[model samples]
Target: MNKVLISADHVITGPADRVITRGAVLVEGGSITAVGTAAELDTSVEPEVPRLACPGATLLPGLIDCHVHLAFDAGPDPLRAVAEADPGELATAMADRAEQMLAAGVTTVRDLGDRDALTVTLRDAIAAGTATGPRVLAATAPLTSHGGHCGFLGGEVTTDDEIRARIARNAEQGADLIKVMASGGALTPGGPRMWQPQFTRDQLRLIVDEAARYGLGVAAHAHGTDTIEHCVTAGVRTLEHCSWRTAEGIVYDPPTARRIVENDIAVCRCVSGDWRLFLEQMGPERAEAMAGVIRDMRKEGVRFIAGTDAGVPGARFGDYVGMLEFFSSLDFSHAEILDMATVHAAHALGLTDTGTIAPGMRADLIVVDGNPLESLDSLRAIRHVLTAGRPIGM
Candidate 1:
């Protein structure tokens, strides 16, 4: 196995309990063999091995975006774009988006929805090293109620049997995870209200039960309070959009929050950085209230995983800087911001490996030019990206 040494002024090891400091990492055969002080490794190894040195720079695990829709173009009318474009066009566009994401220091991503299951094909291509892109966990299609949000992508079911059939088909098609739209969405024109529960409790339960039977994790898109509770009760592995709403104003029940904490169900906030569009759609008062609720949820002991709902209107891939800034606006410390995008985000997708820089893990890493600890915005200053120990062509 050929070895490479990378030395940096600061290494933010994403592993738990690791302190940030100056260090060097030894990579051999696409796995990190050692990480320690530069003096420590240099004194022990041969003097002639080439070393890529980056003084005053910070090295950390590559970032992960857990919620994305590669089929949508993140434009004014993303669904309409998907509806108009052919499969080949969408695939090529998705490949471009994936490369852009890698250049932004995102090494792994989870695509929650796609049309015609093209995400699976792209994922396979990237994994085979035939394409330059991030490691992908693709959801074949999101399950939804008839005429519900994103139902156009297929996988709508009216009965438990139909739900099982859809799950089987997704598994047969090589999906990495299962996604379900438990509530209506704002993007789907004339769809059910965003706060309305789209599926019956029984139907949701059956989906979860069957998905578990196949060793597959599920991410439920739930915005309403009732739907969030229903998804939790059904043992959903991950909850997306978790933006709760009700008829009598927004509800924030402490018991329900505690249940999510106890059940260890990861929650993705799916925050958006399009301040103008959000203000226009929600008005100033409602938008402020929604933002406040998200902050409160974080305070109430609910685990918040970072995801930008990329490919939604105005939410572009490789633009996670907006999400980091959003978290900063919420008063999250720099450490918290990085954790949400790195280690915590990986756990939300049921991915145990490839989140951190460590021995015996996949060599998916990013090299930045500045200290992200000093300024989260430095993430955009990507210098190099490596997947499986091979440099990604920019």
Candidate 2:
């Protein structure tokens, strides 16, 4: 069971976009040991070794979604749904959502926010084999100001003491990273406006420093222009949304953006599968403007990793490839887009083991029916998925 040979019509061994026709990957002890042509690898393996042959399919490193919320259901009133659900019932549903994403070829997902710090329990369950799901990097409870966005999740902090205490508790609970609500959010009704900063500049800096002490990075949720600028100054590891919103409209700041590139800060737009409706929510003109700014910032060397913000009103657990398809409209190559979901995303999340199909990397990979290099739509044709060398059922 420790040795597996996965052969496919095409294998994408990446950090770069290299494709090998009739390729095979050898995985042993949950890590990739060899990758080459099917013929080359087949002859080298013993006849007793298990071989999973996938004809007319493309194999690539498993996809990663940089942001999602497992607490809410993708319904008109996910907040209400969360409030009403039984705690035990909610935990079961959240585990189901994580597995749903795994079936769609997403092998890893960063859970940014959830009620009751439930995501941390889910993460441990998956790792301990009591549950089946993607490798979840959970932010147990996102730090927020009193009456700020997503405060109901119990991460409210008005003083520096409160902030430090929250981080300490989350770290003790085995949180993979720290999430901070740097700005407001639309989903939280009684919270700050979507463009308002939730924490003072110094407070935000303190959060980042405190997280670093625990060997964790901070993912700041910022949508406002000023708030995005502040996150940059605070030296967060990643910026969620980075929407650059203002009362005037979505604004782009070149100076702050330049620093983002120079400092190697990653940006997660959290663009979900509901692209059309999401754009509609922003209005056509504003949507176009946001798209334009994303394009401009890409040119300016800003790195955007993939995230669906799943569990929102229209975002689904299995719709991660749809998010990648949206990026095609943004003028990125299929290879570049795939990298965003794989290598770029893993790096952004500080994950080193699962992003590439190479020696010493985890055997987290997927086989789709068609070549994704030709059309990203082929990504949806998931035929098989491997999470650390073990085949997972769809």
Candidate 3:
């Protein structure tokens, strides 16, 4: 069946810089067959599956969130919350959050960490149509150095053999990608300083090599300078929270920044607007140091992507506008910020089929009530959203 959707106003086609005003998008099966002005198409004789007319909205490819933790609750103490919650309770909460994200116009999300592989199960349920939510890329477990950041998910590795075993286990469970905690983190109580390296170069090399053997990409949670160096050396495909700070002060690595640009390894900022609160708690000096490093990295031509680390503290699913606003503060254009959330993020997560609105693309799209081109705030007024040609209603 062929269906035509006449969008409200403009249709932003994504990184390709294509737009159709007073646009209409035609879908056949699960793929888009045409995109043009409504007046350009003669749809009278077609099968006419249905039309979702949004007279005041702009349609674009589904938004992609490259980082999230389905297992963690956005509580004052998320790590403690995860430990206290039972598996059943966590599953129910995660499912609810997924639906909230879809309702808010996020059609795809990459779950970077979860306890007990719940995300994998949730992904299957969404695909089977048993759940109402966004498409998911599940990282069964995030590999961590023994007692390193987020080590509670049972992915602490002390040796190369342990690393290999973990990757094998995730691949066997049908993981979309292998996530490695390469550095210390601020959220882990009494964890190593955020700038400290969690894994040795050889250790990282082993993880990357093993994951490559299974055709799985590695998403490393790295905040420290030394750890980011190890990640680049190990040839990691994606880096999360590349904050680049040391105990002493700002420690931006120019060579590592250049390598990231040259290698095209995607970097997820995962910086939520709530970072201000965390900064205040940690003190102004440390925040300033880290901000300096981030600014320098951006200036060094790093390939940055958007991720709110939602589910942690103040970051929540469907609150991605906070991320875009943060990027805007960093001097990224509105178009660049949207690209980081859409095409760049999709490419980072290996979802090439659903990032853009174009011919032969998967019909995963969202409509907003205003022009996102004019301002990022337009995303908040989502009129409708569709995943694979299936309309989803709140």
* Number of the top lDDT candidate: 2
Candidate 3, which segments miss by more than 4 Å at Cα?
42-49, 279-289
Q: Rank by lDDT, descending?
A: 2, 3, 1
Cα displacement (Å) at residue 133, model 1: 0.5
lDDT of 1 by residue, 1-394 (tens): 7777888878778842364477888777667778788889887767887687878687788888888888888898987898889888889999999988888888888899988889999999998988888899988889988888998888777777889999998888888888999998888888898889998888889888888878898899998999999999999988998878886667776677789989989888887667557657888788777788878878877777778788988898878888778778778778877888888887777777677777777777777878777788778877777776777662
Worst lDDT 10-window in candidate 1:
13-22
Model 3: pairs clashing at backbone N, Cα or C within 3 Å: 8-54, 8-55
Among these predicted structures, which one has the highest TM-score?
2
Q: After superposition, which runs of candidate 2 have C-alpha atoms over 4 Å from their true positions?
A: none
Candidate 2 on 154-232: residue-level lDDT in tens?
A: 8999999999999999999888999999999988889999899999899999999999999999999999999999999
Kindly provide the TM-score of model 1 when superposed on the true structure, using C-alpha atoms: 0.96
User: TM-score of each candidate?
Assistant: 0.96, 0.97, 0.95
In order, candidate lDDTs are 0.82, 0.91, 0.83
Residue 186 in model 3: shift from native, Å? Answer: 1.7
What is the clash count for each candidate, in the order shown?
0, 0, 2
Clashing pairs in 1: none
